[model samples]
Target: MRFPFFSRPAPAAVQPPVADGGTLLETTGLTKSYAGADGELPVLSGIDLTVRAGEIVALLGRSGSGKSTLLRCLAGLLPPSSGTVRYRGTPLTGANPGTALVFQTFALLPWLTVRQNVELGLEARGVPPRERARAADQAIDLIGLAGFENAYPKELSGGMRQRVGFARALVVEPDVLMMDEPFSALDVLTAENLRGELMELWDSGQFPTRAVVLVTHNIEEAVLMADRIVVLGSRPYGTIRETVEVDLERPRDRDSADFDELVDRVYRIMTGRPKDGRPAARPDAERTDPDRPDQDRTERRTLATTPLPSASVDGLSGLAEMIAHRDGRCDLADLADELGLDIDDMLPQVDALDLLGFAEIHGDDLLLTGDGTAFAHADVQDSRALFAGAALDVPLVRLIANSLSGAPGAAVRAGFFRDLLAHHYTSEQIDRQLETATDWGRYAGLFGYDAGRREYRLEEPETGR
Candidate 1:
């Protein structure tokens, strides 16, 4: 599943220097926090990043990693709780006229035509109507929206609307373009096309925007588009974990060795796994599998306290099938692009397979276990039995089942489980974990949850009786 159109001849070297240019935008000890009932909830902490002129930097992190918050602070849309954001050595107190933002939702005015929408920014800057119209027209031509200038946003497709978004940003002729998941909302083909187009535009040096800051959850997008990729850790203190340089030539081959290696490197950093490919101890591995309870439990609690990966059973099965199809192995980046999934969408399923011991995440490849291959080829009943056995072996699921089975009424209050989970997870994380637990329990036929009654009851065992 590789596209030749996405590949180009490798250049001698495409890597930018450690310091590419004079910093166009710089953050010094930037921190953001909000007042909360429990205490102050910190979103970002002591973070620093720089975007130089003519560079594209991607801020990559998980859902709550404050990537968007950092983008806002950089664009002067949000005030930081502390620290300083400077533009060319000048303090940025508010929205900078030299910076423009493009949003994920295509924030175009409903009443405005494409041209009008593009002109809106210029109007706000007190540009005369004639000048605004000319700039908007030029931007429309630049983004390949020349023919649709008079069309309303509602009449445009998702990709077209986003192009309008790009045009609107470009019409302002900003020095810095801040993009918040600009291509995420589009279909796979559209996204790839837009990404390629953007690279072409940047390479041609026709656009006035001198720098770009992209906020995204997609590792492949970052690798493809960024000069430097900054990975942010989990919240409520999303700090910089590491920064990676993508030195590959443009039109990067997703299947190329170097590209895949870079993708795997980012994955390891995101999952806190070693690049040496030694397996990280999965959450239920120690307790459910019971190999080393003390160390495993400690590690489990630490990971569970963070936001749970949102993986679906279907996603897991699909990924497993892909790996099995590839002879029990598949490159993470290639598989992700083949399935039209972003890294954010793909990693969770891989993580779920790892957690259940069905697959091993070795560097950038997903290798199915014997059980995983069996599960992939198994009949319905056999598959259910296999899953049931695995689910009941998970420590949290086992704990819930034991609580219900041991109770006098053969049921336990949901609050009890919630409290138990709360001891290890934040409130938001607890909610996600609870949802995950419920789904796994249901699939395994190990427990039945009564949402209205807020209780869990033991179910008839499905296998290994």
Candidate 2:
């Protein structure tokens, strides 16, 4: 699977640089389904994630449950069937300079020493030799692999080898660091020690990752480490069953009655009865909260589901058909002209829809396929930003599924995120008649327009009437 695979191309104005820190990584409608001998295998579905700077999020699930797959998707190691993985506001492709992954197998080269292994990624990306070397050395020391810098992989212990793996990924100074069951190969004692050390290092900011995602099946480890623990359902494939957050006081004691109760709570959630709607049961504080372990009935309600946005059916076909059927024989140039887009900026979108079986890209002109045409005919209510993010033709359909719940039937909002784009689009540009461009600024979610109201919505209500 490839990275930067968006169900649709993102708005150009949404490009995010390394400096943005508040909200680091977010995934939308992430689903990875594969064709198999029997039938389609759904690995993970509708995985929406958010990782902020300086936070540690743990992915926990039984083996074969696609926790690893989710991590890979997050890392751009795998492409999602229907969704978007955005780093800051931009799409994630391959291994970005800001992100890297450590595999469960510790994919280290036997011929390379610890230091050399760490330098591989940097060198591959064309970093100068001197700087790469310095980074590798620093990473090695941070992971306590300092003395093993010159040691070959064969000479190192399993734990040391994993450390080398961590170092290789860390040298890049990524904004997001992902480890897929990285310590499963080592013995419990070694794994425990390494986990503690890693946590200590991260706490001290010895490693440069803005956020870290660790995948593990060990409930205790996840409870001890993560700010949030995501447990995916077992699968040929399935969606996340539960995500238990640990807002416990630090230095968690496994032997304490509180820890034991929290563990049981998670176990029950995974193995016990399926509760209500999507995010599942409400756990009692005695069962889940690490901080208030002794308080059996804490104030917080567990398993609060985020409200799903109304399904915005901004059918590309609807737009295409509006033009094609209304005008007859729609051509790319004609469509572009109506939507206010240039041929160049619109190419990727046509390619994406074609890839998704949504449209057909014929030689010179494009036409909506049956499914595409169907989508077009259906009315949708989406994040007003759909208009802001898409080529004049296609809509930011995901936002519709995420933000539209209020309107009755056939609710569609325009300009939902127009104001958010204000920072990115110049006054002249916003006034420039939104064609190919859209402001993909931070917190753009707050700037969409309610389709019914036809007014741009602001996070903070605009003062003037």
Candidate 3:
């Protein structure tokens, strides 16, 4: 698996992979929160994780699942509100010296040449200028950026800039290499090429770092690269939902049955389907009887406890139609592939359908309810009517409708809801919640938002009710 480009002699600082297994990074009861406008907003909770030597651990989850937060915690970029993050068994007081982070955006200085950027870490460590140059040259050559060392970041392609990022991190020779969606910003082909090359380097036992931690939303990418995958859940704040071990050999075949099976298993876990065929677990306080009526279930939910997924009525309805076309049930992973979407891209829509009682996840399959099938087969106006009824079953949409009903001129300021949501969500989360609520409310003909006035007005003669 070794590539000729990475066959250069290792510098004195670039150590070979150690066979003696050791814990590189460990976190126990690590909880992170931010102070919101009204109160504290929890991001990650009770995470007990460990990254061992000679392994690549992928933290996998959709956006808002605290994948990046957990990565930052491991890198000691952000302090946890409680618990400990330890590097090689020592608790971190500040940045973990044993780790180096590569950002998704390729955070390179435009003014610095590629060699200089790669030398930055060495410079900070007070390495002699000549030694720094030598180390930087070795790293640059190892990453296939030898000729481009004199080029500034502005003159490089996205992939080249990212290579420079890798060289910069490798030059420091940190014990643990931390990457936050580093390949996500590159074009698909380029990302694949770069990812393959890096994996080759690792397989060849020449990678500078002892362990790697990667944060990603792409399931296939995680399966392709990680020795272990840690899946994070977003509901009721972030927590480690499941950890899966990849038993397949390296330079893995994506088309192999084993790989496909593993991907499906991860999908089921991510979508809250238990492997034992039982219903997925929910927070005790938020769980409701499945036999309960729609209104009763909706009544049990609140905006704070049940945040809306950022799914549009159109997008979810389209998914419903596709599922109906498959006779009301389909494998979620197959559906994602058919739609040319990553599983994470479709999760919000799946969540929306589940939230509105339009669909249910059974094992790895998405099965449309009787209501979902009908809505999918209905004509445009009829579908809208069906969707309106279903949207009303969501708490946020219900709240907005009720508020507009009780307000003067059948209108209420959007800020009123935003302020209420602030107590439970960060400003960014608040915006997303309101955005989803607004989309559902408008599609349901229950409310309309005036951007100019920031008001939600009740629709005339609401049809859903």
Candidate number with greatest TM-score: 3
Model 3 TM-score on a 0 to 1 scale: 0.91
Q: Give candidate 1's whole-model lDDT.
A: 0.76
Once superposed on the true structure, which residue ranges of model 3 sit more than 4 Å away at CA?
Answer: 1-19, 281-296, 406-408, 461-465
lDDT of 3 by residue, 1-465 (tens): 122222232332344444536777899999999988766789999999999988999999878989999999888889999999987678999898888899999999899999999989888877777878888888899999989989999999999999999999887777888999999899989999999999999999888788899998888899999999999998878999999999899889999999999999999889887776455654432444433345456667888778898888789989998999888899988888777677567999998888888888878888887788888888887887887888777777888888866544588898898888888888888899889988877776777888999998876564333
Per-residue error for 132 in candidate 1, Å, reads 2.0
The candidate 1 region of ten consecutive residues with least summed lDDT is: 1-10
State each candidate's clash count: 0, 20, 0
For model 2, the stretches where C-alpha displacement exceeds 4 angstroms are 1-21, 37-39, 274-465
TM-score of each model, in listed order:
0.81, 0.54, 0.91
lDDT tens digits by residue: candidate 1, 1-465: 111111221110122222337677899999987664345567899988888977899999887778999999998999999999987778888876568899999999999999999988777766678777877888889899989989998899999999999988877666679999999899989998999999998887786577899999888889989999999987446899889988999877878889878887898778666646565665543343322223353245333343446676666877788788899888776777677676677777877776676776656677887778887777777886777766655667777777775433477888887776654445675677778878777776677888999988775444212
- Please list the C-alpha lDDT of all candidates, in the order they appear: 0.76, 0.58, 0.84
* Top lDDT prediction, candidate number: 3
